[model samples]
Target: MSSTLKVGILGYGYATATFHAPLINAVPGLKLVAISSSNATKVHADWPQLQVCSTPEELIARTDIDLVVIPTPNETHHALAVKALTAGKHVVVDKPFTLDTAEAHDLIAHADAAQKLLSVFHNRRWVADFLTVQKLLASGQLGRITHFESHFDRFRPEVRQRWREGAGLGSGLWYDLGPHLLDQAICLFGMPQTIYVDRVLQRDGALADDWFHAVLGYGELRMILHASMLVAHESPRFIIHGTKGSYTKEGIDPQEDALKAGVRPDAKDWGVDETMGRLDVMRGTWMQHSQVANERGDYTRYYAAIRDAILHGAPNPVPATEALQVMQLLEAGMLSAREGRLIRLHH
Candidate 1:
């Protein structure tokens, strides 16, 4: 419970650049003390003052580091997280937690055994559009959600030569974007009663699935989760319909793009995108719409929560168990897609 918690970040790829660095820099009581990356050139160029290592093991072995942020490839999350927890360091692993629920459970077991704080970086839950949706729902504007559709589409026709675009256990859009969208849905409306899925590899040379459409059955409510790589244009990120009215918002969160361009988390226009999403509603016989500015997405909160949880006994913002639930949903989605059957969830 030191006043300044020293932190170490693993990997310097997209996750590290777009999330770990900026957010770590923004949070109080958390100092970016060290980093581990095979190619530390880029990270060193960005933060020259920190101690840079060549491996995660070396980083976590250092007693000076109290917290470790794992932003490695999807296949490595479970292993790295378990290792960090065993090293007596609080850990933050990026989603989707693991390839399956078994691996997630194993990591959870290790974390619990070590009595370490483990959390997942489900940053999409803090997206401006999601926050806006929360506001709308809290206002009781979209009464008793009957139908909901959320899309996390992209227009990358050609599969880049990366782990994510390959045919591996944790590759593809299902593993890459599934956790973000699904976890947000789970947070808003508890786990769905049942799930049905449809998945496809639209591109010619694509080795992994690039398109997926999942339907979550909640009695009278049907929630659709969609993601595709070949979409030349994307649909609204959120579309909700209820008994009283409907809300439609089209646009993606700006934080990712901001962090990519070396924009620090504390920038004045940090989460601002001129093309912010708009909400359209249809109530009774009248149609009403307003372009509400997307709420400011504060990634800083994740680190802040971690600091408080580790130092002040506050609850972990994205608990390891909550992440396991997301992994369960992802596994169920994949299983349902392959078997062409609906998955009946247990509690």
Candidate 2:
């Protein structure tokens, strides 16, 4: 492999334009060489020097490309990743790995057969607030967490005419946002023993589910993962209650907004979130409340690690097995919602 890996993105859609392209360019050893998109004009608007292929097949067939990133629709992830792996290129698929667990398994088999690196883009693992929570828990500041709640709420009252809001297989809040929350929870605490989900379409004329509440049970601990499109008031992004103390944080990570605003990842203050989390603990007889500074998030670390994995045999940043675990939880959550009962996970 060359010292600099050439990368080709499969789509110029929202995920690609906002997250993949910029982060790929930010890393030193990864080169954003080309993009496969029908709209060459749109591709050139942001990346004027990039070679725009008219179709995904053209990009995958290019001999110069060492890595292929699939940031297309959720349903297309498995197929595109298979193609990229068959072409002997390292593959990266945006989250919700695939529409279902079977598809995810198929993609993993293809990558393994081809002897190539396969990774999923679970970018939220590097979110500023999440990193802070990870550090806090590691320090034993929040001892033996008993309850944890994570929310990804928004106030989009109107259901827009998009694939995400349409009545498609992978076009709902559960499939769209559930992966991030599930992946993060699995990172903090291993796979849960059981999962229960309640999904609903709360907005008028909403063809797909716009709200969901999922609970994962880990022995005595209860984890709540929720998302809603009708929340008008701001809610705590994370709430944790442990035997020793509690930690509550507000506001989402600023990286996504910064990327949408065309801010480069190399910006001096990139991923610096000013919103501090409140940490409350007992001080002998009184409860003490203090502010905990957030840790900076850098999505570039993901791609940088991927580059090293391909070039220097480093471990994959987000391995296929880890992503497969997330897919299993995703499917379990759906089943729990459909059956209106708790779904037990078997290892």
Candidate 3:
């Protein structure tokens, strides 16, 4: 109710430490007043002013908090978000919004009935490389994009024992990395007609799938989304062949790595990175052109949108309907992977 939105964070793990905490601190009209974490010592060490509670229930019960950001695990998103919305707090859930689409719908309905804002943190939508791709596509530099390929290959051969890689609900590269790839694709190309998926557990003693290759059918355009753990090396981060030209780039965005290294969001060159793609066009024979420096990634925009929506009555930037569409794409991808067929999406 005050000028600043009082935010109570649920869980203080990787997402909270890397994305939410730093960006929330950087935003002007938000206060990180409380947090819920079992590891009280670690919480205090990182954020001394934050009031650490033992449970999410305790944090949500506080009348002073207006927003609850759930950076919990992939599986718990639905239940925690539902609880937060029912308790009358606007909610911002970290992505892979829910393990299933039905849960997302339920949460949306609850939030709508409560007249509260509900958003999923699809932050990669603002990544420098993705923005660059958007710019090229809009400028028609790629002509008619017939084929677009995105690779998120990594070199970790050993299986991580964490829940993300272990055998459980909401595990595997598909659920973990699928949202980013799927959301970006949906943002650019809208819903694909069909998707052909090939999923595998390539690593030794791997409990869940660590590799995936999904081909999305975008009418005349054929887009391939791929990820693997056994890859000792990585291909170009992006490769697109359009009618007029082709663009290729070969490095991960530096923002995530920077955040992992404890870099503040306010630092110079914070989200600026040198991982831009080169465009080769057909002028007479072949003309190669280097892309300009990437636009700075502004993750704070996500929370800023949330603030304006809650305070100023603007529309939620990442609409619940779009999040539902991403969920639909995820479910379709899973079905295609399991059945070895192209899953068709009905509008």
Task: Return the top candidate by lDDT.
Answer: 2
The TM-score of candidate 1 is 0.95
**TM-score leader:** 2
- In terms of lDDT, the poorest run of 10 residues in model 1 is 272-281
What tens digits encode model 2's per-residue C-alpha lDDT throughout 133-216? 999999997779999999999999999987889998789999889999999999999999999999999999999999999999
Q: TM-score per candidate, in order?
A: 0.95, 0.98, 0.97
Write candidate 1's Cα lDDT for 1-347 as tens digits: 57999999998887787778779978889899988987778887888888889988999899999999988888888888888998899888888887788998898899889998989999888778888888888888767889999999889988789888899779988888888888988888889999998888999899998998999988899999999987777578888899877777787888887787778887898766555555556667887777777677777877888899999999999998999889889988888988999999997
Q: lDDT tens string, model 3, 1-347?
A: 77899999999888898899888988999999999999988988988988998999999899999999998888899889888889999999988889888988998899899889889999988888888888888999778999999988889998867888899888999988888899999989998998888889988999988999999998999999999887777578889999999998787777788889989878888778776668888777877676756766878889988988898898898987789988888888888888888888788
Error of 1 at 309 (Å): 1.3
Name the candidate, 1 or 2, with the larger lDDT value: 2
In model 2, which range of ten residues has the least summed lDDT?
281-290
Worst 10 residues of 3 by lDDT: 287-296
Q: Which pairs clash in model 3? A: none
lDDT of each: 0.85, 0.94, 0.88
Cα RMSDs of all predictions? 1.7, 0.9, 1.3
Regions of candidate 2 where Cα sits further than 4 Å from its true position: none
Error of 3 at 24 (Å): 0.8
